[model samples]
Target: MPASIVEEFWRTQFATEPYRGGGFALTANPTLEEDRRAMLLVAADGTETAVVSPALAGVTATDAASFRAASAEAGARLHDPDLVHYLAADDRIGEETGHDIRLLTSADEDAFAAFEAGASEQDLDDAYVELDHWAVVGAFDGDELVCAASAYPWDDTQLADLGVLTLESHRGRGIARRVVRALAGEIIARGYEPQYRCQVDNAASIALARRAGFEVYGTWEPVSPDQ
Candidate 1:
């Protein structure tokens, strides 16, 4: 990825309280989280391979046959009665039901505060800090921020990145769509490509990406145990 784009992605991830305990991790980081998480689960008697950070808990099988069997068993177990949503990502799934745009600013700490109040700890579990590379646009209803979209980290190698959100109370309306388009336009104006990712099973997010002219590049699993 281009250094600029890469830098921006990290910035947005760390911002808005979305990233809490888990810090920035690249796939090739010498100290891989997958290796670490696998070691933690060593007593389970399972072969291990690496999945990316923050998702799949970084557990796969070292042995192909054993891995396949374990994957099947894991899939079955994931669907069992106890686990609801075995692996979840902050995939930007839900829709905006009904709200007007209030356009937020950095000075509007109250909006961030409200956003923090309405946000889940899991939603806030990323760890990134600098955001000099990207720009942002937010949607608010009155003083309450119902949705937000940010554009940052654009350059030659990495695709431009966007981060978007809609409050839980706001769904089904075109609020998310509007904010996304607004953010995408901003990203284009800044001269970088835009890339988006969501959980494999998240229909709403997949639909939104397609609607916004994004194709599935690939899937990236997050691997922060704290998340």
Candidate 2:
């Protein structure tokens, strides 16, 4: 029941121009979108299904138990899952934070650069956060930026994709969650739903999403190419 709100929309989303998975259900999505060779979308309520390419459907399995084996045999190995999160319109938070989190612009280039310079290469790469995006926010300490988030359109849809990064030295203070809540409001104000995605094994990211009041919409992955 938790995913009832998304049923009609997600089915339509997959059936439209780009994806064209017209028959979205617990069964098959007849016409698979090229970009998404195969997808297993498990709704928040635990309802699960797969949208597999017609060419590969015969060998694919929809059940979680056999999905990995079938996908692996077809060259699209299913290893780690990708969790997708969404903030419902009613769940929007309007609370203010003690930290100095604000929307950023090109004028703050140097500050953003210094924040990046202070982070380790490995952490930055894994964070998948960038300074350039449709909407950027920063959490400041006095005048120094320690946490940042970038939001961009996802699949050119009404969903705004978001990524956040907090300096290793500045973590555990709830900066990421506060910054995300502030940004989600901005995304909705701009006429788009805020969407967050992260790998299943990423404990830190999962925690952040939970703390930010985001609900797990689905676990999606490509059947053939990590889809």
Candidate 3:
């Protein structure tokens, strides 16, 4: 698919990443917060573009230059800077380790609540409650939830972005991989492509995506206000 089409889908459906060729295409959305608005696009031919809305653009004279500087500073603060990876599903060859994986719904509130109780971070819980295009699959060991994966609509087209979480006690096992595979399978069966995104420094997540047959195609990093 052309990168332009992908950009359109992301912009219209997800209200983000409004990329057009080597430039940015602005779209009006009253709900977008000025401080949280920014876009970064790295094209296949090595061309790149970074855009900030008019409200935030004045903070820096050049969006691309400011974004690059921010990314460099972020990298110095940590082992790796924040990055968004574009991934596509390829093949599925991992064994299904017999963990029961089930889709979550409003009826699964109790199970979700239990899973939330063990959550190490808040993003999953916040997305679960707020996103309308969200879908979740949880992996269970006997009666306990060990890991879960969730996908949210990525664009107006057939694309979904996914995240996975495995309880601290279950890190080494393949539960994360299994849950992601199951979630990706469902997303594909529903006629959408699954996109796996994670921080570049998250080795466990990167390995899980690879184990589940996803390959990285592109990377993006945004400029934060503090930077």
Candidate 4:
């Protein structure tokens, strides 16, 4: 695999080496606010780091267990970890699914709204793809938008994070594979790295990432939404 952009992105955030070279580094996350967010970032090399906001930084240490305990004490519970994948440029394997996936724009507003309206709330939240987002792409089923993808730069990094949604009635048709390939290719052509993230429990997303040429980079346990 090419050098992991995952490492490069987090490095600037920590203001120090986030990688422990197979160890742990519990550090304060400058970007987070107190009592707002706390979580863990595990690098591909087995390096674990407890990323807590500055306020809670004093309560944790270089121990992963202690970091978890501290986070719980701060009234924040660990959420489901997200499996992270970086697009493997040299290893990009392609497939032909007979879907004419293309880049979409604001002109496709009505179609995207109709597609979004057809998706359930759960699906909408899970996919997180939006038509008005930074970049949009999709495929049509005859005249209906059956599936779409969108991306945004991850933090301030060159990594373009990806989200893909397939119409509930149109999954299992290989639209996802083609859509992802098209979007990732677009991101690459724009001179940015592509990153795919999904909950570890999402079997379908995991499978699609692999088949679409994304390599597992690491797992991130970000703070759960405030409830």
TM-score of every model versus the real structure: 0.49, 0.84, 0.64, 0.85
Of the two candidates 2 and 4, the one with more favorable TM-score, higher being better, is 4
The best-first sequence of candidates by lDDT reads: 4, 2, 3, 1
Model 1 per-residue lDDT tens digits across residues 1-227: 22344335434432221122322222212333332321111101221222222443343554433433443443311111110111112223233334554335567677766776786665543211112326666677787877776655633344655656666787576777777766655655565555554455657766766665554432232322342
Candidate 4: the clashing residue pairs are: none
Which number leads on lDDT? Answer: 4
What is candidate 2's CA lDDT for residue 128?
A: 64
Clashing residue pairs found in predicted model 3 = none
As a TM-score, model 4 comes out at 0.85
Question: Model 3: per-residue lDDT, tens digit, 15-101?
Answer: 556454554333334444444355555544444555444454333324455555543443311122333444342354343556788
Q: Candidate 3 at residue 156, lDDT?
A: 52
Error of 3 at 216 (Å): 1.6
Off by over 4 Å in 2: 1-9, 13-26, 60-62, 224-227
Candidate 4, residues 1-227: lDDT per residue as tens digits?
54456567766555566566788876666777443367777767777877766766567656666766778777776777889998764755353357767789888999988998999999999999988777788999788999999999877688889999998788887789889888887887787888899998999999999888888878887666761
- lDDT per residue, candidate 2, 85-164, as tens digits? 98754684696487998999988899999999999898787766777789888899988999998899877667788989
Query: lDDT for each of the candidates?
Result: 0.45, 0.74, 0.59, 0.79
After aligning candidate 3 to the native by TM-score, how far in Å is the CA of 195 from where it should be?
1.8
> What local lDDT score does residue 136 receive in model 1, on the 0 to 100 scale?
60
Deviating ranges (above 4 Å) for candidate 4? 2-5, 18-21, 29-37, 75-77, 92-97
